[model samples]
Every structure is written in C-alpha cells, then in structure tokens.
Target: LQQFLNASKTIDEFPNIPESSKSLLKKYLTKDVYKKLKDAKDANGFTLQQLISSGLANPDSSIGVYAGSTDSYKVFAPLLNQIISDYHQYDVNSKHTSSWDISSYNFEEFNSKHKGDYVLSTRVRIARNLSKFPLGTNITKEQRQQIENLAIQAFNSFEGELKGTYYPLGKLTEQEKKQLKEDHFLFKEGDRFLKACGCERDWPDARGIFINPSKTFLVWVNEEDQFRIISMQNGGDLKQVFERLAKAHEIINKVAQFSITENLGAITTCPTNLGTGMRASVHVKLPLLSSDEKIFKQIASKHHLDIRGIDGEHSESKGGIFDVSNKRRLGYSEAQLALDMYNGVNELIEVEKQLK
Candidate 1:
C-alpha cells in the first residue's frame, strides 16, 4: 500500500498512468485523505488499499476504485464521495432516488422526430447486484456459481419474449467467443479496470450471458455486476428498446432481490454508477457533426448527452459512428434518464440535419 501511494505521488513511477488521466482516484487520494482512511476497513474488512487498488494498477482508469460491498461507500466515504460527486456532478451530502416506472416513458415525441438512417442501433441497459451477496469485486467463486444458478432459475420463469438460453463462458469455444463478439452480443474480456479490481479472479468459472430468441433482449450474469439487463436492436426504435428492458427488469426483480438503497438507488461496484446504473445509448453516424469536434461536443453537452466511441468507453470510434448516451446517472428517475436519451438523441439528429 505504501509503495503504491509513493508511486502515485510521482507521475513517472505511477506505472502506466496516462498523461491525460483525469481519473478521480488520482485526483482525490491526497496525503491527508490517505493517512486518515488508510487504516479504515469496511465491515467485511475491505481496506482502503483494496478499494483503490484497481486505480493504482490501472492508472488510466477513469473512476479507478471498486466497492467490495455496500459498506465500502460508508467506509471510504471521503474518497469515494469526492470521486462520485466529481463524476456525476451530484452533491455528496445530497441524496439520490431511483424510479423504475416504465409507464411514464412515453417516447411518442422522440419517435415522431426520429426518422432517418443516421442512427444505427439503440440499447438500454441497467447494472444490478444481488443484495444478499458481495459485489463481483469481492465475491467468492462459490458465490459466483450460486449467482449463476440463481440467475438461471429466474430466467426459467420467463414466460414469453424473455425466455432465452444461457451461454456459460467456461463452456464457450474459441469460435463461439469470437462469434459473440462479432455479433456484439458479448462484452470484450481483458478490461484492465475490471481485471485490476480482482473481479476476474475466477475467470470464466461462473460468467455467462442470456439472450432472447430475437437477440434484442439479453442479460449478462456475473460480469462487472451481477446482471446487466439489456434491450437493444438494429435501428433507432429506442421506445421499444426501453420498454423491453423495463419489462425484463420487472420480471427479474420478482425472482432476484437487487442490491439498492434509498440514497444510492441501485448499489453498484463503482460509485459513478450507484444510482440508476442505467445507460441509455445509441450508435449514431454523424459525419458532418463529428467532423467538427467543437460543435459536436457543444451540441451533445447542450442535450445532456455524452459521446463515446461506438465500441464503448476507452475505445476509438469506428468510422463516423459514435455511442451517444445520457450524461447523468444518479439523482434522476429511470424514466427521466430514458427520456433524456430519447429527447437528446432526437435533438442531435435535428442538429445533424442542419449540419450540411
């Protein structure tokens, strides 16, 4: 711990920390805070070093830390709170609430305005963890296997569109893994951030994915979180995508008790994703807009949207395609965030139309 702290103090010896790193862990873990919280441990004995180990290892990580359990938020409040506040732009003292009401997500206006081929696909996904278990960062192999079994049990209860098959990572062949990635049905492995956090300790022992017959609806079991409930399709029918995700979540909620709190909404491994834990995003091609970086950022920020490479965070954009999604996570209702992506994308499309 002291060695990493010393390295953090010097940019040159900080390992692979990038020159452009604006990671919260790098910014907030000062000498004073480290001394104050170094000896602190959560109920599960999750130490400050364990909490920030990932950040130290993956020096370029954006958020840098992972919470071992719900108590991590309280035990490392000073550091975690600062990082969360900076990333989400939410006041640390203020509370956040979550709303999973699907009835209020009326996207008629979005549907009406969106009428073009500029948008490729829309996906809405939410991260969830089981309340009875520790997060993936600290979960045991036995716990992961149990979660996988539990997820399959819940999946068996799906009566209609949600009915799907589970593909365990351990059983997948090399070709199958390649095929899933080519189809965008699987998350890429070897993420430095996840690896550094000890989430990959058991490797493919219990990780897997669930997909419906249509491939639009899916669930990632034992990934970064316990479940990444997703609904997506080719083309800009975000309304249907959001509806499908909401329905799947409701069904799964009946079988598995998700980790959540009154203040954090849905508890996740990272503080940045604490509330809501949902990302409503779309793959959009805007040659004219993306060409002008300044205008593109200006417009996206105006609509409360964030732009990432089509392949997701820390990746480069493919062609002119970019992944655009709502910026804020916590302190907003699910319906509102969905609407933000819906309305924001529509606005982006409108701006694209006028871009020449």
Candidate 2:
C-alpha cells in the first residue's frame, strides 16, 4: 500500500512525468484510480505493481503496461480495458473475431507488378503466447526453458519449408551474434522497457531464434511474448510473405495452444498488441513522399498505416527507406490487416509518384 502511495504521488506530479511520454499509464493513471486498484491482486497473486512497474520505470514507454498473466486482463480490466479501447479503438462491448484465411489473398495484380522500384523487402510477423503458461513478465526460468523445449519439438516436427535450426541466445558465438544483428534477426538484450517489467529476469537463458534454411521464416522464442513468428523476403510480395506466415501460424498451433479470447483475439503482454498482435511491414524508399513529415503521416493515417524509421520504431530513416506497416491490430482479421498494408502501400506509392 505504501509503495502504491509513493508511485501515485509521483504520478500525481505531472512535472515528474516526462513531456514526451505518451504511454496509457501516464495518460489514464490518476491518483484516484491508483488508490482504487492499489490493494487489488489477481487470483495468481499478480499485483497491480507488476502490471505498471515497466511504465513507472520507463516513463517514455508508449504503452507502459503489461499483463503478468492472462488473468491480469480480468483482474485489471478497468485500466487495461480503457487502454485497449483507446489504443485499438475497440469497443469494449464488441467481440473480436480472428481470421487467418489466406485463400482469397491471391494478389495476382501485385504478383505481376514490379514493386522493386520502391520496395526493398516485405515482412510480416505476429506475437503469440502459450495458453498454458504465464507471460514473460511472470514466467519462471524453468517455465521459460520449458517453452523453449516445446518450441524445439515444434521446429523438429516441421518437414518441408518450415524445417529449421534453433540457436539459443546463451550459446551464440561472437560471430553468430554479429551475423544475426547484421541481418536484423536478433533481439538485443537490456531494453529498459522490458527490464522494468520483469521480462528480462532470466536474461538469454532460454531465449533463442528459430530460422529455416531459406532464412525467410523465423520465430523468436521467449522474448516479450512466448513467440514472435515471422516471414519475410526481398521485394514487395506482401501476399507471399503473409502466406508463409499464415502457414507457420497453422503449424505452430498444432504444437501448442496460444492464449486467445473472443474479445481480444490474441492475448499478449501489452494492450496495444492484444488483438492481432501482427505487424506487416515493408522497408521501402519513399524519398518524395517522406520528405514532408506532415504529409507522409497524413497519407499513412488515411490508410490506417504507421510509418517508422528504417531501423524500426524510434530509429531514423536511412537512404530514403522507411518502414511502412499496418497500424490497426484489433477488430480486424489477420488477412484484413495484411490487406490493409497491401492497399495502403499501393496508395502511398501512388502519392509518392505524384509528389515532386
């Protein structure tokens, strides 16, 4: 209770919160709300402290909060629901249905069109958690290794294109680490946001990456979430990338159950990723379109797209290349979100062509 009071006091002082902080924790967490939820604890003994520790420690976190367990949703619905509705623009009363159907995603037009003029590479990835385990924030070291073992079994079960090797982070050689970082396939250690939330407790002990022979498909095990399945390749073949991801999603589901709900679609640690937990992106050159930040953002917003730097979020664009991706994750199907990026990128290219 005293800890809650101190944290609330700091939150009450607006000056203490950084001006650049846009997290929901900083936005919706008022003294009154904190006081109301202070003594509350979920059935699993997950406390409100565990939920907001990350946000409190990293004031600049965009979302600033996480779920220690799936039960955290029901236990902390008041704050979490508000954040979800605000970020995802989801109606709390409405149901969230997931659709991974790629049958109709046959983008014949895109297949024939030469997108190499502007598009460098296409990538699609989704965040998923195992239904039987607690999230990274609350998972024990033993549980984390167990998750890794399960992933190993799943990877071994793969036959055709999905067959791959698992490289544990703890065992990575200096050269291997450099190679992974250079290829942008590595998740670095010591993220302040992740650390504050207790996700970094076991460090790289049970963490690893599973990549197939082609290197186009990969999965990050025991990161912020249980799994971050991804598919990528050169050029702007969104359909191909998404199709691969969908197939992997299907295969993984056969090995383990993902934490999911009719109201949330895919349950994740962060509220912003609660629904689809998917991000379909392209690192493309949009020199003219991106020159004017305001116009670039306006056009992106019109198509429900988000623009990020070439090195990913918070980084700067390089050599006229920018990361363009779907902004909406909730209240939409997996295929719908992929289509949103496909159509949105096409629109962006058109706008770019018209620009000086």
Candidate 3:
C-alpha cells in the first residue's frame, strides 16, 4: 500500500502519460496506485489512465479504466466514439469503425457446454453514444435533455417485440423503482466513480429505462452511456438474449444515430467499452472455485474473463455466487466477444464440477 502511494511523486517513471492527463491525474488519483499506470501505454506516449480516469476517482469502478476516445480517434469520430486499439498501437489503419452485423451472433451456437443449476440469469448489453455530440462530461444539461427526447422518440417508433414503455426514474415511485432493480431490470444509483468523471451531470432529468412487456428487452437512457440496449432472462439462453438485443438495436438505429467509426462500431464514455461495447454476463455459484482465490484467478485469467459481484463491480459476491463476464471488448465483433465469454463460462462450469 505504501509503495503504491509513493508512486505518485514519481510521475517521471511514466513517460507514456500525456501532459494533459498528467495534470488531470493530480485531481483524479492520489499518490497511492500511481504505480499501476507507470508503464501502461497505448499510442504515442498515451497511458491507460489517460483513457480511463474514473478508476482513479472512484475505487468501485470495476476495472477502474474507461476506454474513452484517443486523440487519433477523436479527430474523426470526435468524442462521439472512444476507440483505442492498444492491440495494434503502432499501425492502426482506421479510426472509424464498421456498422454492427447484428445478425452474426446466435448464443445457442455458443452456449456453455456444462448444464447445471449453478447457472442463473444471463444478460448482454451494448453502450452507444449519439453521433455528433460530446461525451456526458462535456455536454450541457439542455443537450442531455435533447438526447433523452430523441431516445424516447426512437424507442416509441419500435414495433413488434421492440415495443415498450419509457419509465423515467423521477416519475416512478420509490417502491416501484426498487421492484425493477430487484428484478435486475434497472440500474442502481450512479456511483462516485461516474460522479467524478462527469457522467452524473444531469442526474435523473433525462434518465430512465424502456422495458418491453416481457421485460426481456430493455434500454437504459442517459445512464452509463447515451444508451445501454439490453437483452436478458432468468436462464442462460445466450442465443435468445443476444438475438433480442441485436434485433432491437437494428430497429433503434433506424431512428437514431449512434457514433460509429471504421474501427470502433459504437462510441462510449469508457475506453474499455470502446469497440463492441457489449457486456454479456451470467450469475452463477462458484463455491468451490471462490474458496480458492488463486485458483479462481487462474481459471478466469485462462479464459479472458472477469469476476464481479452479483450487484456488479467492487461489490462482494453473495451466497457463493459471482457475476462473470468477458474482459476484452475492443478490436472484436459483438459476436466474437459473446462467443469468447460463452466458451470461458463453459470452461469455468466444467472446472467447478471437477472441484465439487
């Protein structure tokens, strides 16, 4: 702990950190944890923290790193898309991303091989930004409202399974809101992490959820990003869950413009969510594996997966159950990200069975 804090005074150690981010870091991070960013680089002298500052401000920020747009991506996509491909830092051909091929994914084909009661519900979501607009931090309150109004209009235009009602957070009673959250249909309060990063600027003024009658298809307005289109259910039918989101996304895109580039499909506030912006996850009990943190890390690391609490990042697992999801999002297609997670979960479930 002392070593981490001591690193703050030695910013010279991180030559990759941009000057602007260095100044910003003074306000965002304490001396502690400075070492974590020491050698983390992306492009020409671009540190990871430059792309994700919320982690320094809020400890609860899951990976504590966001994938905001790099200077290169910002030139073309502007703040609309946050595309950073450290994977090919030296030679990134395009700052723009391709349009999403929603139909390319079908979770049934990639379902977990193991079948057990250990698995609970499954969810897949994508974060998208409205094109031609600044990010949440830089936008004004009026702009936020405009984005909200546009989203409502887009959602209302939906037909078939995509049809739903928008429930503004301010309009719902406390009890009603609690019920939705209990069912995992709504997001909880914005955490300190987001508050520090400027994502909580307008609060509930333009924020809410749009849920279809079945609640299987939903969209969060002005939450973590401009939109969080989701598909989820009580069990691990990844194919059905992903299919719903893809279909709904197709419908919404017709009426709305989501920031996209040749390299990044959807723009988002966080750099980690830059590429596909898909977070496909499941709730499952991992009693045996959880008991051994080292073993758990080994297994999860081997599969490119991450473990979070049922309530999400920085929270503790309860009743021996943990939330598991993919770690990589950028530089891959939506189908690839989901497929990787499905394969990784299968591996975890099989290993859990062996431990039992």
Candidate 4:
C-alpha cells in the first residue's frame, strides 16, 4: 500500500518514474509496467496478497522476468494506451491558438534539480547494449545467436521508445566545447560551423539547425520545434510545458483525440494467473463460502484453475479479500487483448455451468 501511494505521488508530480530508474529497469521492465502497477489498486476490495498471488505485483526479481509473463503484459496494455492518450491531449491544449502559452516557464532549472541527465545517460547505456551485434560474447556461435534473439525479444517487449532531441548553446568557449564533446552531450551547430569548430563527430542528419534561446540550458523533448521567444523564467509548470509542445503538434496536424477503455471483468490465465488473470478481481467470502470446499477444489482442479484458502498466496490480509486486475501486453491493441481475456473467462464460466 505504501509503495502504491509513493508511485501515485510520483505520477501526480511528473510524467512517470524518474529517468534514472527508468534506465536501470529498461532491460527488465518498461514505463508501462510502472504505470500498470501504479494503477492496479482500487478504492474497494483488493488486498496486497491478491496482487502478489496474481503475479501482477512488482517483484524483487529482474523486472525482465515479471514483464515476460503474459499476466503482467495484460495488466500493462490499458495503462500504456492511457498514457499515450494523455500525452496527445496535453499537446492539444498547448497550441499557439490555445488560451495559454506554457513556454513562459523555466524547464531547464527543473530538469537539473531533478536529475534528468542521469536518466538520459542510463537510457543511452541501455540503447548501446541493445544495438550490439552479439548479445553476449562468451558463448558459442549458436549461443550468441540465441542471445541476440533474446535481446530482440526484450526490445519487442516494450511498447515504444523514449526519444529526445537536445541542443546546446553557441557561446561556449574552446574548453567548454571540448568538454561537451568528450562528455557526449548534445550540441547545436550548422555544417559549416561544426566543420570550422574541428569537432570529430559528424552532425546528425536531421534537417534543422539546433539552437536554444537560452545560452546554456535544456528543453523538453516535445518542445524542440516550437522555437518561440520565451525565456527560462517562463517554464516551471511541467504539465504546462508538455501541453505547449502537444498543442504545437495538434496545430500542425489539425486533428487530435484521446480515448481509453477499461476492462472490468474476470479473466483466466496460465498456471501463473489461473483464476485471476486480466480482470480486477477481488476475493471475497461469497454467500456460498464454506458450503463445499472439496467440491469447489475438485471443480477448479478439473478445469485447471487455482483454489486457495481464504488466505491465498495472492492475498495480503489473512482471511481478507484479494483483488487482481489487468497488466497490459505491448504491441497489441486493447480490443484484441480484451477479446482474449473475455474468451478465457467464458471458458471458465462454461466449466462452472457444467458443475451446476
């Protein structure tokens, strides 16, 4: 519960988890996992045990294992859709024609104080590891190929990429330029300017010249194209800043929308989440509780379902209720995933009808 509260607080304050944690967990987990877990708990009936037992809880193991499970994937999908939708809406609200101009706030100061560099650095490392040809060098050729396949599997496990385009200022002295280059920091320059500066790295093939009005500051990833006349003093509200960029995109495109679907039904699963897979189910003492434990166990076993005592592995409070909900899968539409969940539940219901 405390963990859930902390996660909720973080969402209220920023886009998602701090970038540092996102980088460290990227290989094992995705931003979607955090979003799912954060949104799993409800105002009624669910307990911590239910979450753990259902395999929807965030465990101490490599996030990779948890995310690899189909159960976790189901829980993450809806949340990812919501995040994308929200980002789109924020964009719509920040356009030039919109009543507000969020660019008047200072974003660089907020980023520096909040450890944005550490987060981006970690992501760069993850990308470097992923782009390698041979996944692990020590093994045989066949094993190396297998590892490479596994890396591709890992990348496919994520729904999308975290992208940003950074541009540093032009007034830096010779020593500053050298440090920036050596540090792998992003800088701005035209072809002629870069060639004259004698920097060893080639310019990024993008068409635009990178420049920031502020002499030595960073801008949000979504805001790079605006190129407005706002100062750093105008950028503190993070939501407002993101909204500005989102609005710009909406204006350029001329159409925008945000929508999400919630699956509020029971779902079945593999051995891991048998009785409570995709649904936000809560274990309760039904009126039929204690009526026929043996019969219930036998029925469940026959159909490959799980039967737990009142205090099941997924239950947090002894004899209290357990609640479990969906964890989304990356790369699939919510409707397709929902149909899968519904079909599983339908099978279980058919089994129950047979027993009756």
Candidate 5:
C-alpha cells in the first residue's frame, strides 16, 4: 500500500486509482517520494488497477472495502501511516527556526467531486523572508536553493497524506455522498479550477476551474512554475515579499492616502485636521521615523495628527488594522509622493508655530 501510494505524485500519474485515494496519498507522502511514486509503474507489468484486484481481497484482513469485496484498505493503509509520520517529522524539524514557526503555516481541508470520484483538497501557508535581496536583482544561487527547498518540502508533505487513504473513499457516509452529489461534486462540462497566490491568478480555462468551496486567504505554491499565491490573511509577509520583489525589479514605490473628506465642504469634528482627517501618513522608501520628539509633537498638535504606535487603533476592532495599505497614485513615484506628504505636513506645522 505504501509503495502504491508513493508511486504517483500528480493526479494525472495514477488514472486507475480513484480520485479520493489520490487526494489522500498526496496528503501523506514527502515531496520527494511523491514525485518518485508518480513516475513509478506497478510490479506485474500491468497497471496499478490489475495489481490491486489480484491480492487485496483476503477475508481475514482488518482492512476491507465496505462497498465491495475489494481489499482496498490493505493497499492504502501504509501510505496513510507514512503520511501521518512525515507530518509529525516536519512539525518537529520545523520548530527549530523561529522564522519557520507553525504559526506562520496555515492549512485548510475540504472535499471535491470530479466525474464520479470524490477528491479531498487542502491549502497550506508558508512564510518566506525576502528582505535580504534588493529590488530587481537577479536571484542568487542561495536564494534559488532556498525557494526550491521550500517548494520540495511543501509538495512532499502534501503527497504523504494523499498516498495514505484508499482511492476515492474518504470517511464519507452514504448520506454525505448524496449531499455531495446534490452539491455538484460530480464534474460538469464547464467546471473550472482556479488558484491564486498573492497577486497572481491562474484561470487556465475560465470555465474549467470552478470554485467548489471558494477560499480567499490561503497560500498556494505551484512547483511547475516555481511561483506562489499569498493571501491577504498574511499581509505582513506578503508586504515584505512585494517590497523585495519591487527592489529586485527596479519598480518604483508609490503612495496613496485615505481622507475623511473628498471636498472642502465636508464637515468633520476633528477641527485641526478637518481638511485631511486625523491621520496623515506617508509610505516612504527610506524607512525613516520621526526622530526629533519636540518637532514631532509640535506638528501633531498643530495638525491634530493622532500619532499612533505600531498597533494602530483599527486593529482592536477590525483585527487586521495594520494590513491596510496606502493607496497608489500613478505618475508620481512612491518615494517622491511620500516625501511630499511628510515634508508638507512638517512645513505647515512650522509655519503655524512661527505665527503663534
């Protein structure tokens, strides 16, 4: 069973294996093993199907198929066990690096039906640090290796769990099967499969990639292209990655600000900052902070700048307060616009102090 599960890494590799089994096998095997299994052939010189039918139906075995007299369970259990074991191993090895904490890893599991088969799908999150590289620079050998390692590890862990389960028989009840059918797990002519990570979207055939249960905030990595999709849920990491990429690509920075009023006629309670709102923030490329305390306070008082600490006020109520990003205005670069916002505020405050 272990060998069978490990034989195919991709869905296309094992056509004879039920979709359910393929999904489970994917969950258990390491990326390396999964790739090998994907490329492996059955022992009998026949396909995986022929080998399974010959030996799986022994009566004394604990693993038996409920639907039919097949020994499907015996063929699948070892793969599942291997997958579970691999997960634990990863969990243990991953703990040593503060950067690779499980807290940064997010996952979701669900089931999908294709044709007459049921498939279990999962999404996992991974944290990658990219601050070391400057924008637009070619990836160094070290960086390339790091990215490859992450991709291989992720795929292996997924493959392990996938190999463990018997094909197409996820612990679903008869009622659940009926419900799933009603919910359209069965493949449709126009069904599409779409996956997005970070800012990239994959709509190969828009009609072919339908969302079974749509997921918004998850990371997906595709080894074929060596690209990833990062959801908004992990904005901190996403932002860092974006910044790094921008530097490497020589992309200019841009800034945009939100205001309470769109026009001068709009009335606001915050008298001092009525025109601009209580917040006056700029996204700067230099990564500078207000160092002169006296100047900072004077400006705050004059403009009614509610200088917020790292934990912004919106966080307490909305949860992801810090995730809100500055708007991007075209034409003007980010660094130039940020300088204008901060310097303009400082200039206004200085003028106000002089008049007083």
Candidate 6:
C-alpha cells in the first residue's frame, strides 16, 4: 500500500533513485561530489529509491539529496557543498576555531518584544548524530541501543536546569506515547518513506524521550535523526532557550560524540542540516500573511525562511498559525541561524500589522 501510494509499487526490490530521477540532482551546484561522479563506478551504498523520493515529492526543496551512511560520501558528494558553503560563509576552514555561540544574539529587543499577540512561541531544535555511527537510516539494532546507552549516560550527566529523566518508548503505554506525540513532545512512528529506506526497523526498539525537570529542554534519541536537542517555551523568550541549549549542548557532548567533519561542522542524516543542524522556529499567527501566501512566501524566501503549518511538516494550519524557521543551516553559526529568524519574524510581524 505504501509503494502504491508512492508510485513505487511497480518496482520490486530495494528502492534506488533510478536513471530517470538523476535529473533531480542537477539543480544544485556541487564541487567535489560532481567531479567524482564521472569516475565513480557504483552508487556506493545509496539506493536510487532513497535518493530522489523526498525531492520527487517536493522538488523545490533546498537540498534534494541524502546520504544513508558516511560511505554516502562515495555515493553522493554534492552534499559536500553544505560544508563548503559553511566554510565559505564563515571563512573558517578548521573546526577548531569555528564555534557555535548564542551570546551575541538577543531576541528580546527585537522580535520577542514586539511579538504583540502576533507571536505564539519560539523553539530551537538541533539535529545531531553520535560520532562514528551510521545515520539512523543505516544504523544496526545494536547501534541504536548503543546510542540509547550513550544518551542515558549523557542525560544523567546533565546538571542544574538540564537534568532530566529518560523515557524509553518501548516502556511507555499507548496512551502515554500518543499524548507525547500529540503534544509535539515526541516523534511519531517512523514514516513509510523512512521505513522504505531502512531507517525505521525494530519499532520501539531503542527510541525514547529525555526531558529536563522543567520539561522546557529535551532530546529525542533514535528519532528522525539520532539526537534532536530542543529548548522551547510558552512565549518568545528565545534568548533563554538558546542559552539553555548552548549549555546543554556543551554538557551532552561530554558523554555523546556527534559526527563532526572538520569542514562540514556537524554531519546529520539530512544534507541540509549539515553545518549547524539547528532549526530555530516560531509558531506565529499570521492572518494577513495567510491571506496573501504569494507575498508571504516571497517575504519568507527573502528572509531565508521555511514555513510550515501549525501542526508541523505537511499538516494544515489552524487559526492562521504557521511554523517559520531558518532554511539555511549548512553554512552558518547557530547564533546566525537564530538571528536570521529573529529579524525575519520581526519583519513578518510588521507586515502582518500593516495588513490590518
């Protein structure tokens, strides 16, 4: 049924991007990866089905390609551009000097203060992977357990406001699981798309949530990505959230090693999340922007933003609220990512007021 729905039912076997779908790769300009494609003998570890399906669904996607493993570098290098762009944007060729800092940004003076009933809430989520481990798509069951074990050690090490409890999905009741998901506090079951790619196997195997005592900061282990570190609040206090995440990131890394590239910064299952792996977002009420989607989209594009429904990723908006977040993550610092959205949301709110 899933294949029938994806138009992949006619083909039997592991999904590959296929010859016809290679055209999807032409949109982005990549350096090292493309040069190697001419001499490369095989698809490395990637299946054609895994490469193009997501983009086939949304061609306008900024980064259309994916790598199932570190070997994916041999399979697809175009994503290497994520690192190049990051280095070029920041002029940092070494990870030693490059840094992730939220100290320079203050959301209070700008967007958060003027939120004025227009802003609902702000969130910052960072996607990270355990070093030397295959991405979620290609990780073994034991590897998943290993990640869970590492996470338990790390979460236990958290101190002060960051300390929390680990709730393994395999132990949770159906009601508890459903509630976490509905609250957007936990990830849903693996999607059919991910299942096809071998990302979701042995359901409820090692998946779980770790929320701090305050519940304002949490991490999702073995979800869409290995680790989705999140800090959020009821209103737009982005400074507090960013600072908390920065401290938590510092503490978590002591126990968990994230896949980091000297040039790429931090590597993730998704190419777009390469550098920062951070998606700082705001749930905003945009009645005026909703009324003029074309203009709204143009403004969002100008601000380098991606807009989603209030319910998130493919769900429809309720009461004119949308999730707007930074679209370019591969080439900037974490602070810059948040800053872009802070300034952009301010611009959006200004437009919303004028429309009234």
List the candidates' TM-scores in order: 0.92, 0.92, 0.76, 0.19, 0.17, 0.81
The regions of model 4 sitting more than 4 angstroms off are: 1-327
lDDT of 4 by residue, 22-51 (tens): 222333234455544644532322222222
Q: Is candidate 1 or candidate 3 better by lDDT?
A: 1
Rank ordering of all candidates by TM-score, starting from the highest? 2, 1, 6, 3, 4, 5
Location of the lowest summed lDDT over 10 successive residues in candidate 2: 6-15
Position 234, candidate 2: lDDT = 80
List RMSD in Å for every model shown. Answer: 3.8, 3.3, 7.8, 24.3, 26.8, 5.3
- Compared with the true structure, all predictions reach lDDT values of 0.81, 0.82, 0.68, 0.26, 0.25, 0.71
Instruction: Report the lDDT tens digits of candidate 1 across residue range 1-356.
Output: 44334323323222344557778888888777777787777766667766877887776677889998887888888888888888888876667776666575666534346566787888999999988988887787899999999999989998787899999998899899889887877988988788777777778889999989999989999889999999989887777888788888888888899987767778998777778999999888888778888888887887789889877877789888899998888988888888788777877778788986
What lDDT tens digits, residue by residue, belong to model 3 across residues 1-356? 33224222224543333324433333333333445544454333334434444545544343344443333244322222212343212124555333345455444532244656767889999988887566664456788788889889998788888898998888999999889987888898867767655567657788889999998889998887888999988878887887788888887887778887656557677666777788889898888878888878887887778789998776789998989998777666777778777878877777789998
Worst 10 contiguous positions by lDDT, candidate 5: 191-200
| Clash count per candidate | 0, 0, 16, 28, 53, 7
Candidate 2 deviant stretches above 4 angstroms: 1-20, 108-116
Rank candidates, lDDT, best first: 2, 1, 6, 3, 4, 5
**lDDT tens digits, residue span 1-356, model 2:** 34334323322232245667898888887776777677767655667777888887888788889897788888788788889999988996688878878677665334346333778889999999998888888787899999999999888888788888999998999789888876767776678788777788768899999999888999999998999999988877787788888889988889988998888888998887888899999887888887788888887887899888877767788988889999999999988998888888887777777774
Instruction: List candidate 6 stretches off by more than 4 Å.
Output: 1-65, 78-98, 109-112
Error of 5 at 204 (Å): 26
lDDT of 3: 0.68
lDDT string for model 5 (1-356, tens) is 33334222223433333334433333434455444444333221222222222123222221111100012112332442343234222221121111111222221110111121111111121112222221001223344345434433332333211211111222445575466434323221111110111111221111111111222222222211222222211111222332222231121111111111122111111111111111213211111124345764564454333343333322221221111122212222333322333344334334333443
Local lDDT at 191 for model 4: 26
